[model samples]
Target: MNIQNIEPKYEILLDTICKTYETGKIKAFNAVNTELVQTYWEIGKYIVEFEQNGAKKAEYGKALLEQLSRDLSIKYGKGFSRSNLFQIRAFYTKFPKIQTVSGKLSWSHIVELIKVSDDTEREFYEKQAVIENWSVRELKRQKDSGLFLRLGVGKDKKEVLTLAKSGQIIDKPKDILKNPYIFEFLKIPEPYHIAETQLESLLCDNLQSFLLELGRGFTFVGRQYKITLNNIHYKVDLVFYHRILRCFVLIDLKINEVRHQDIGQMNMYLGYFANEENIEGDNPPIGIILSKEKDELLVEYATYGMNSQLFVQQYQFYLPNKDELREEIESVLRGDNEIII
Candidate 1:
């Protein structure tokens, strides 16, 4: 009967009601999205079948789509633009088997996916999108950033196919590495002088976006994470725990090319984390020396036969150039060894 005492109980009741409502809403939305995508696929199939059967439609090509778009808009009222119709048609063409189209994705997601020209690249994006539960915008960003090409580069056809099927299996330290990890979302101007502290601050400020760029299962632990050895002070620029890998990821940033000393330091950090930071059931930590560049030969020698799971990779302030990325992928595929990592 007391108003003050009843407030907490009412709030709890409201919270439970809202939670139950949201669960039902999500299920309804997913069911609706699945139905819409199936309908679009059926429409696309009908158009294709008509095109095959009708001489006028077969001859006119896009003319048929234009007419269909106008007619469908008259009946449905909206969302039947010629461009969208063409997209729906392409979706069916790309995924001829309706079973292959994921019920998890909305029509908006499919619209972005059908634009990919390469089968392998498209499959990679599709599988990752579903597995990662990426939004349509996120899907577009990954496609534009050439994530598939980045992973596929420096590998043979078999490896590329495996990657497409597996969707970034992080079994080892190197599995999590991306050469020239993209931080364009940080909006740091190129050719501008910035200290490693500033870069680390920016990344921390944009941690959510950074985690997405870093790929799945990374949970940020801290920035400038400290690990003292024999009273000597040492700091890692960023520290993260990979849920899947079951290890701590220690990152050190360098504005310039990585040197032998950086490699040695990373090796030390890995040792300290493995021995001191890691508890039972935790794997040996991974150390990534993130820099603007790395001298491959020097790194190769510095890490020779020494096993501490240390890796050196570059970071770019901006997006990797598409033309250069394409050229590099092609070169690597053609047995060209010019671009090392």
Candidate 2:
């Protein structure tokens, strides 16, 4: 048979093969996600029941898990380790309510949530992970890097807890700001050379993780979103619509340290969105400047008395040492002590 004469038949076969491959891939992905999530839910149920039934037996839960692990590993195989069982127990304790676990997050994400000691912080990260569709690795890095503590440190405990349990309920503008945004998902080195364009590109490439770090309800609208004021064109680094907040989230990325001018620019962006794009029933647009560093005094002065909603937050390309972040939190708490002479 001449090769050229067979070309049409070969092309049809190739197209069918590609279609079948894609269908199989989709089915496999769904199967794996469903299996992992269901397993975690069952583990949570067992742990909760074990604790309730055997409260008088000091080592009952541990012994039960050990025997169950051995039996399950022998019969079914992988992911039945003693440590994983402990994680499942912790998962139940952390999120007792089934409704709290969103379908988008897998058991792997829940495993990362087990490491968070603070219940409020754990809930916040979990909700954000599901809402933003964060990968398990991204979830782990964000939790380990102290993202929640950094955001919730100065906030009222009750209000912060409410946000964690429910989700971003932005009754006030300040509620939308996370003081120090974690960007370890980009896998960039800290204190390394990088430009604004590079940062913007990395964020857009990993926009899902960026949204997770930003918190819940953020939907990516565009990058370098263009706007014009009086014939002058300006581009916002990233644009998002926050479903829960019912407003646009205009993010401006800065490579160098933040300045008053950055805040002014963000305020202008917010004003434009409010006046030009805001619709009925929509709240005022929120502006955030994500920079390498920020001066607290400068941010206070720049945002003070300005009605337009604006925030200045620092972003770290690398995960800081966990101990270092904890120590810093302790130092800040101590500094807040009002010393009586």
Candidate 3:
């Protein structure tokens, strides 16, 4: 049978058959995964109800779980171990309302989510994971890096509460900003010194994790993205298109504190992108200066009159020092700044 002798119509038919098979396979896989998640959730619910006797009990719960674990392991094999049972029980307790549980997520995803004690924070992660189609590893990375906490910090109590109820909503350019963007996925040691180029390289190597940290709707465009004006050349460290916001996002990385010049250069980048690259359908571009530190007063004064959306944010190579970050957030919210004459 010569392949060249095959009719075009038959070739098209063959392609369609393959596509249909793949679609069916995916649907079957999803259905199986959904049922597995539901079964685990039901088991979790049963364990919780059995342990509840009247109120939450520590010692009684421990004994009950151990006994149940032993009995279930004997009958069902490995999945019903004491640790697994504890995870399941915690899962049911965390999501008391079964309706809130997502069948789209696997047991591994739920295991990661169950560790999040805050209802609001857990809800945010749950919604984001489904919306973003995060893998278990991505979900774990986000949680370990404190994505929710970083977004919640600096916000008022009410705003922070809102974050738990609804995942970060990007209504405006400012709404998309998170201070001290965590880059823990890069695996950079806390004490290590790395240049801007090295940072960009690490980020590109872990692009998926980087985008997830950046939040929803971010699609990478390019690195060292060029802009030319008056025969002078300038390059953005990284560029991304935000599908939701319908705008270009330009990022500049700095190993040290941000300065007035950094803000000015970013403002220029935004202007160039707005005038040169932005088409009729695109929103004005936004710029972010990601540095290790920022002078609050300098950033405030430098960006005061800018029409473009410009933000100076810090980036941590490792997980943030939570207490220090919290203190800084408090100071910013308090509007405390020192004047330098």
In terms of TM-score, the best-performing candidate is 1
Task: State, as a TM-score between 0 and 1, how close model 1 is to the true structure.
Answer: 0.92
TM-score of each: 0.92, 0.67, 0.88
Tens digit of lDDT per residue, candidate 1, span 120-142? 77888989999899999889888
Model 2: colliding residue pairs: none
- Which rank order by TM-score, best down to worst? 1, 3, 2
Question: What is the alpha-carbon lDDT of model 3 when measured against the actual structure?
Answer: 0.83
As for candidate 1, its clashing pairs are none
| Model 2, position 72: C-alpha lDDT score | 81
- Candidate 2 lDDT, 180-283, residue by residue in tens: 77787788864578889998998888876777677666799999999999999999999999888899999898887788887888888998999999999999
Q: Which model, 2 or 3, shows the larger TM-score?
A: 3
lDDT of 3 at 332: 45
Candidate 2: residue 282 lDDT (0-100) = 93
What ranges in model 2 sit over 4 Å off? Answer: 1-81, 84-110, 123-138, 164-168, 321-341
Query: lDDT by residue for model 3 over 259-287, one digit each (tens)?
Result: 88888899999989999999999999989
Q: Pick the candidate with the highest lDDT.
A: 1
